[model samples]
Target: MINTSTMVAPWWQQAQLGIFVHWTPASVPGWAPPYDPAGRAHLGWTSYGEWYENSLRFPGSPVSAHHRETYGSRPYTEFGGDFADALSGWDPAEWARRFRAAGARYAVLVTKHHDGYCLWPSEVRNPHRPGWHTPRDVVGEFAEAVRAEGLRFGVYYSGGLDWTFQPRPIATAADTVAAVPRGAYPAYADAQLRELIRRYHPDILWNDIAWPAGRAAIRNLVEYYRFTVPHGVVNDRLYPYTPLWRALRLPGLRAAYNSWERRTVVSDEGFVPKKPPYYDFRTPEYSHYTGPDPFEITRGVDHSFGYNRNSGDDSFIGRDALAALLGTVRSDGGNLLLNVGPRGEDATIPPEQQRRLDWLGEAAGVGSAP
Candidate 1:
């Protein structure tokens, strides 16, 4: 029998602030550098990065127009080479230093987004698109840097979607769910995740869109707990649909934390009812919320999570707004997860985002060792 009394809460709970990096091949041109609006009527303008390649799939979409005008019928895979060249100069240590200065207690990096480009070279080949991965071990280097700074390290895996496995681009809301790989993808993801565990031993496992609804997922998660990290932290996003997966897994295996990311309702919702659906912590992105329970608010320094050259000074979450947000989230008993979307060509945080970090760092006792 496991003794529940002696284990202390993982460091992530105490480490209030974090940095969520959203960088991928989309950052290369950096589709308008992921997801350009199609035609005048095709959603006008949007910045959801996972929809980058999808936008390119639309012949009349702005993404395709821009690509045709610029790259001229070049396949999306072509950008991988550009991204690789850019990543060659990436400085993981510099990023860690910046995070420490920005007052981040932990850092979550996107090892793989929906586009299916693995930041780390994976032995698990994508049957649909092999050799799409970079030679760099981005996850490993970043993990080392963050841990060296005494900050918790976590990885974000898109267990639910990998566009390489699906040829059709996601256009409508229905396409989002439909694009989920149903064949050998679960097992393929399983192999990659196992490799992640074996190679990185991440302190936090942040799976997006939830895991595949199958025994493979269950098995991977079980082994994750059993071997990789017995007392490690995990977020509530383990299941794509909460209502269904909530009852599917072992009750004891529930994630250590509950996260509500990418949702915009930021005002305080009185007291959070810590009942059946217990949430260790709540995440409020780009807004502030009121509650006694722990809440982590996320702020994307720029308009887009992935690199977007089009984002001007007006679109950025500059020093003033960031300062205000930091104060607000702090006062509300929450953490602020400031996001930085690095450029694909250089894997460097844009100058605008870095300026914001410098502002935060200039303040006294901010993002300091606690």
Candidate 2:
């Protein structure tokens, strides 16, 4: 097990505030049902717009019904073209300015979400979905822009559950474990992550879901990352699907695991893996950690992290609520990684989301946008 305690506290711990940007092809059809933040609903009813493709696969799910009514049999993959076209008008510098004005010390962009779409034109081709990534170097431009504003840059990659590889609707905890792509995915993810480290030298390696590789492989990758980007920090979600998790696929075990997952989701303690090989900090999504360990609270300004066309002012976190949340996190000596989901059609941050950020800036004594 790699010991993060020996390493000095990195810049992230002191940064306090970071902005997480989720801009994906899913934003083209951005819509998700109202989220029950209490974690009462199943994955099929997920409120995350970024999970648009997966939710659409569930029969009779709201996303599927919405897709049929809205797009009229258009495939989800077609959104890639629309997303590419929309990128023509995106201004990375403008986004960077907004983040800086919002009092963000760092900005983490979703280079690749679970939908298997890469924001950057990666050299490591996706065998299952060729030409699926954007032609423009979205990651590079965003990184440059953020750094130019004196803010650290980071990247978020879905190391597990690439929909193109598995194509299964994850409806349960066991399914979520089983959805980790096997065979080529482990190697492909490794290569792509290494490429990102080499090309972008991101200050943070924020992976989602779980890593497909085992402990040894993950350790090697972490070592390489530390050597390449000495100041880089890794999140806790890289926990691999080990034998214990694999056993969850068993009928009886699956039921028990799902029950536990449901309980954990709503627990006041928040969700943290039993024992991971390594992680610089814990990430509690839409939840919080009660332990003294270093943690970062990550959640969108609205219920969904990706732009949701259905979300209104009621779905957003108001200024007072935002202030309270920040105060609580700060009191616990943790950082807050607030998220922004720009529209896929024009890559513009929605006015509702911008309003919250502007409020945050004013509260931080940073002048709000005029």
Candidate 3:
């Protein structure tokens, strides 16, 4: 455990604010990403991400219909077309400027989602990879840009791949009777993970889905931390039993000091109860995928953290909502990690979001970080 006195306060305490930015291949398609028909339908297509692997499993579900409409008989493996020209015009520096103006002290970028597309080039197991990869190391650029603005950088990685690939068992139904042979793909997982750590040196690593359970995963985590940053933080999403992992596996782990924010929809019920010492950080109280209601709280005058092409009103969070969210989260002794979805090209935050955040900066007294 890192000594609090000798150690700096976890970034959450110091930052008091963060930004959750979800950029994926789905972000490129400009269409609703695919979904798991066998699961919840309201989650929308991309909510479960690249569910084509499970499309056959569900057979003729709404998801399949939507996929057919979107791709027109094209196989799911062809989803790379979405990213074909998506980031070609992306500019990370401009993205950093908006985040900085929004008063974010740190930012979390999704390096890879369940779609299995890598934002940063990797030498690990490829997931339906293409001949031409993302022209630039998007993840690397994001980290550099965010840091240039003097914010700690974070990487959000999905642990489980959507079962749309050759090694298909990770996609097995939750209640499947047959146990799929769990291959030792730790090399692939570890390779990408290690590369991220070594290359960008992110301050926080936020993982989703299963935490890559096993001793070897723990070892890789330890080795990475010891070598890259002695004071970096890792989330508990990797462990089933927290206390054991907290004691045995975690040495430099942030002390119940969640530096990274959990991305999810917040409900009107106010604070979501978390396990003791598990900080939810900057998660939104509600999800846009759930559809809008009057009681729904959006960050700005525009009712979203990102640019919602489907929104008729073009919601942008205003000063009142921003202040309310900050006060509420701080009162609960938590940090807020707001989200922003930039346009696919030029990495520009929608003008509406920019205007509101600008107003917020001037009005909310977000002022200097003193």
Ranking by lDDT: 2, 1, 3
Model 3: per-residue lDDT, tens digit, 174-230?
A: 211111113443446666777888888888776654443464566557566656876
Candidate 3 local accuracy as lDDT?
0.51
Q: What is the lDDT of residue 288 in candidate 1?
A: 57
What would the TM-score be for candidate 3 when compared with the true structure?
A: 0.68
Off by over 4 Å in 3: 1-8, 33-67, 127-133, 162-181, 240-308, 311-319, 345-347, 352-356, 364-370
Give one digit per residue, the lDDT tens place, for model 1 in 1-370: 1112133245655666788998888888763533233321232234644356877877877667777888887888888889998877888888998888877788999999888999898998888888888898888889999989878887888887788876656543234445567678777888887788788888767666556555445545645654767656554344432334332233333221111211222133211222112123555444455655456676577656777776766777657777887786666656677788888877788778888877777763655322
Per-residue lDDT over 72-118 for candidate 2, one digit per residue giving the tens place of the 0 to 100 score: 88999999999999999999999998999989999999999998999
Kindly give the number of clashing pairs for every candidate.
10, 0, 21
Compared with the true structure, the alpha-carbon lDDT of candidate 1 equals 0.67
TM-score of each: 0.80, 0.95, 0.68
Which residue segments of model 2 deviate by more than 4 Å? 1-8, 37-39, 243-247, 265-275
- Poorest lDDT segment (10 consecutive residues) of candidate 3: 289-298
Minimum summed lDDT over a 10-residue window in model 1 is located at 257-266
Worst 10 residues of 2 by lDDT: 266-275
| Candidate 1 structure, TM-score to reference | 0.80
